[model samples]
Target: MKRTVDVSFPVGPVHPCWKEPARVKCETRGEYVLRAEVELGYMKKGIERIMKGRPWQEVMFLAERVCGICSVVHNMVFIETMEKISGIAPAERAAYLRVVANELDRIQSHLLANFSYCYTIEHETLGMYLLDLREKVMDLLEKLTGARVNKAYMVPGGVRFDIGEETRHAILGSIPRIREETKRYRGMFSGGPMIGLRSKGVGILSREDAGRCHAVGPTARASGIAVDCRQRHPTYMKLGFSPVVRDEGDNFARVMVRFDEAIQSLSLVQQCLERLPEGPVLAGGICRAGETVHRGEAPRGELSYFVKTDEYGRIAEISIQTPSIMNIEAAAHYMMTGAVSLADVTSIFISADPCIACTER
Candidate 1:
């Protein structure tokens, strides 16, 4: 199994594996990958820098643009950072509403990632089914937030507006369907021979490596790392959140983690609806000058935002640490271990669920 000639290939700035442009320069020996170098910046917009000196109110829209798949969480993290610094307290109902919106976002995001993973494995029918099911979540979001992708519904004090009676009912009613559909898909993905053959025991990442690389979200959880921002975040803490961890640390495990999370997210959304309090969705508060760091569990993983504000209540600086950067880097290392087949590289990369738009930003 030795390489007779050196070979280099690139999976790239325009590849099916990623929604945004990113390049992976891989060196291979025969059928095995010897090393991999991930090249980002193709989608870089210097988002953090762009937020600097912008009005605090305007930053929310800009933050949502960082990544479409997890836009709601991005706005949530940024808004929470602003709220913490400004000492703005959201109403009890507002908090629950935020949770409802976020969990829905998480469900859709996880489904989208798993669907893409299916596509990478050439499971076209399954991928299409997942995408079609995902549209239901999108429809829910559109009804609640007025947009399918960059829902700027969250704000510093609370949500922009209350969830409509019809929207609330729509969301509540949809949970059972979401849960059922997700469970069925999960069964198909886990029990299918093709998925098991291509994923189980392949692209293995050890527990130690996951910790060393600071892997987050499902990627870290699949490796048995018990680091979920939701368990620690104040909001989910109120909701009695729990982390889903699997010890396998393989491509199959990673995909299954998202499936588990999608179901978990549906349950959470149900709770938010059941326990939603009665009060204004937005609170009244004036922006204050200060600095603070906040954390939220995006669909991907631990999303941290550090905000520094000026005396005029404008954003002075903002820093974001997205999960994809860490997880993808860890996956690259795993691929470079020299045991993985060249053909399996994309499958391994997709399992990490890299969002280059989020990473590059």
Candidate 2:
């Protein structure tokens, strides 16, 4: 006779598998998970509250600190929203430069994300390879923006600086290697038998559930939802950007979608470099009293900012909706339920790419 018992398993506020501090409590019977719940609130920075009464200059830098991994999009969206309120439009050249810098940020972010997934699944060699490539992408960002993490490159009227000929040549030179290496690793991820056994058909988040939970970014796209915020952005429209999607809705699909998007992001960088326009990088403008909501696609998904400015152009109220908030809930409710293997529990949660830094903020 065999005996079966249900047990509570917690992976969590501190773990070797994920970089951030958050807990996942799984109810399991034998080797299969019955349900799982995520516990957060460990890393709330109260950044929005701190931003109140601060001028746009201070708020801009504060916004970039919301998430270290996807900081550029935060800076861009906040600045663009301020520009809108002030009736200022960035210079044409500055707009394209913004796109280039943003796409570079996206590439590094996606690579780091995939690297995290690989590491979680115990594929350390592949993870190391991806991390190394990410460093190269970070180097490119440093060359363009003068800072690696919080670039602070975007301004009200335009960008802080223009790219030099040497910088342009270096960016162009680096793309092929990154692209080729990514392609090879993507193939290994897709075709490797052990990887398939661990990833394929595991942690499935169906299209219906994905929509219901309002999943965003690669997590949503992997479930066959083509909901990339970039498609609606004016600059991306000019670049003819399209979202990459897959129907699997599994761990493998989520990771592969990121790989594909990283490759696509590299192509975007190249296009920006070749079609690099010539004009002033900055146009002067001042933040004025107004209210507006702005949305931009972060590496994880759609990030939204709602702002209300006072008469003095200082922040009166601000609210942020980070993609991780939605995705993490979806993972705990939908993706982590059913007969999930205990071994696969963490990988599935990670596939949703929950960023506590963004969520707790």
Candidate 3:
């Protein structure tokens, strides 16, 4: 007679599976996951408190520190909220450039996320390949922003600088190769035999459950929810945008959604560069006392910020709700549902692309 091994333990605060410090308590009967719970707050930085009483101009760098991975969206959302409160409009060229910077960040982020997923599934070769490809996107970002990560590029009314002729020519030359690499990776993720076998029908989050959990970004999109703030943003609308959605609501679906979005983002970058408008990038205006809200579709999902200004136009209150919060919470609950195996729990958790830095911020 064969014996069954019952297991129940925690997988973090220090674990090989996750990059950050988080605690995931997992209970299992034999090899099947019976329950799981995620404990956060190991990485909180009290950034909202720091933003209080600061000028809107100074908060841009603070917001960028919220998460190294989703820094661009955080800064953009903050700037947009401030612009709304102060009634300042960025120039058309600035808006398009903002989209370009954002999409480049999106491409790199999605690639890193997919690589993480592949690593969790023990696909080392694929992970290395993705990282190599991701380097190209990062190089482009470095050229545009002068910093590979956490670029303090956006100012109150517009970006801090403009792309020079040399950088512009380089971007134009690299688009086709980048697009080709993105398409190749997309094909590998969508139909690759190892990924399909390990991810297909695994960690299924049904459409109804997804709605109830308030999922966002590619997580919700993979579950067939079509909500992308980019499609609604005026600048992105002008550039022509659409959400990538899949109905499978499984790990494979989640990975495929990101793959498809990366391909789309490459096209968006091409559009922004080709149609690069000519004009000033900054609108330069004074801030007025007001309250406002703004949203941006980050690589992981919807990132939103609420801003309140004092009589002098200084920040009175600023609160942020990153996509990782809802996505991580909901995924913790989904981990125990259905027939998820104990071995696959980490992969499933990472599929949601939970950024603890952003979540606990």
Clash totals, every prediction: 0, 0, 0
Per-residue alpha-carbon lDDT of model 1 for 1-361, expressed as tens digits? 3444478778877876667677887888778888888887788899888889999878889999989899999999988888888889988888998888898899889889999999999998999999999999999888888988878898878899888778788888888887898899999998999889988998889999998889999999999998887877777888899999999999999999999988988898888888888888889888889998888888889888888999788988888888888889998986456646877888889889889888889
Q: In terms of TM-score, how similar is model 3 to the real structure?
A: 0.96
- Candidate 2 on 1-361: residue-level lDDT in tens? 2334388888888888989999998888888888887778898889999999999989999999999999999999899888877789889889989989999999999898889889999999999999999999999999999998988999889999999989999999999999999999999899889989989888899999999989999999999999988999988999999999999999999999999999999999999899988878998777789999888999899999999998678999999999999899888889888745888888888888889999988
Per-residue error (Å), model 2, residue 288: 1.1
**Candidate 3 on 216-248: residue-level lDDT in tens?**
999999999998988889988887788999999
The pairs that clash in candidate 3 are none
Order the candidates by TM-score, highest first: 2, 1, 3
Q: lDDT (CA) for every model shown?
A: 0.87, 0.90, 0.86
**Candidate rank order under lDDT:** 2, 1, 3
Return the top candidate by lDDT. Answer: 2
TM-score of each: 0.96, 0.97, 0.96
Model 1 residue runs over 4 Å out of place are 1-5
Cα lDDT, model 2, residue 4: 42
Clashing pairs for predicted structure model 1, backbone only: none
lDDT of 2 at 232: 90
